[model samples]
Target: MKRGAETRTERRDDAPRDHLLDRLFRSEAPRLARFIRKSVGNQDEVQDLVQETFVSFVAAARTGKLRTPEAYLRTIARNLLWGRARRPQHRDALHLPVDEDFEIAVAPEQEWMMEASDFLRRYEQALAELPARTREVFRLHRQEDLTYQQIAERLGLNVRAVKYHMRKALLYLDSRVNTDD
Candidate 1:
């Protein structure tokens, strides 16, 4: 076989993997974006984080089989977030003014308060969107600090049902509260 034929054979061999990666990207990108948005205030940064997560996920996927791809993607995103947090900020020394008395004032507390209020508002909206039973389950578990078994007993549901509702509630809330929306 000629070199051209060999290249074509290699491309044909990779077609299935490429298709799988494309499907994975389509399905998981929005979910990952929402997850990252919870921690990242800036939409651009959230997008960048999600892109980085998928880039790492694709690299890993190409290397070996992933038993739980969703979980692996989340782990990659978390590591990227931590890495960004640990990176030190750099300022240009050449741009600094020669005057010794120059000072810069920043109101970090006010900025923090604004971000907190916005998050709370979004969280409340997400909670309100949940089904009544799911919302109650979440409130009982989170606000009242009840165990799953206790919540099950209180709501006359099986423990599994309570757990299911909690999971549904969390996923819905996470998707709804994303700043990208």
Candidate 2:
């Protein structure tokens, strides 16, 4: 039967589905939190949005319209991220001084270079924590600017595996670095 057309009797008759929700709450919460952390740029905001996303998911399920729960949760988080980005406080904080009068005239050259070096070092450390194959593919594509086919050829991995590794590595680093930033 179509989901919404199910009789009220059938809705109450599902015990296994209730157990499934219990398990989902335990298993999916942390994973969703991490995903939200990666997609949004702040830790506190991640926590808030995680709660909001799950609450929305539960509400949708109760209303009998959540066909793909995980995807729906992620879509909620993506929307939250965009909303946060559009807020006035965030906008003001992120504003760049683009006027000519804002140009730097007398900064020491090595200052910016040292900051860049430190940032790259931290970034490399995070990259190094990934699986060896994932790291290798990432560096080849990002640092060496190699195409996925080139990366696959050099590493002897199938192109699909390379793509999977890239996605995993990016998600891992996203949760780790973006949260702290």
- Candidates' RMSD to native: 11.2, 11.7
Q: Tell me the tens digit of each residue's lDDT in model 2 across 30-109.
A: 88888866645568877888888777777767866455566666766665655654455643343365786786443332
Write candidate 1's Cα lDDT for 1-181 as tens digits.
5999999999999999899888988999999999888767679988988999988888878877876787788878866765554343311112445576887553553354445556656888899989999999998887555689989999999999999999999898888777665
Query: In TM-score terms, which candidate is top?
Result: 1
Name the lDDT of candidate 1.
Answer: 0.79
Task: State candidate 1's TM-score.
Answer: 0.51
Residue-level lDDT for 52 in candidate 2: 84
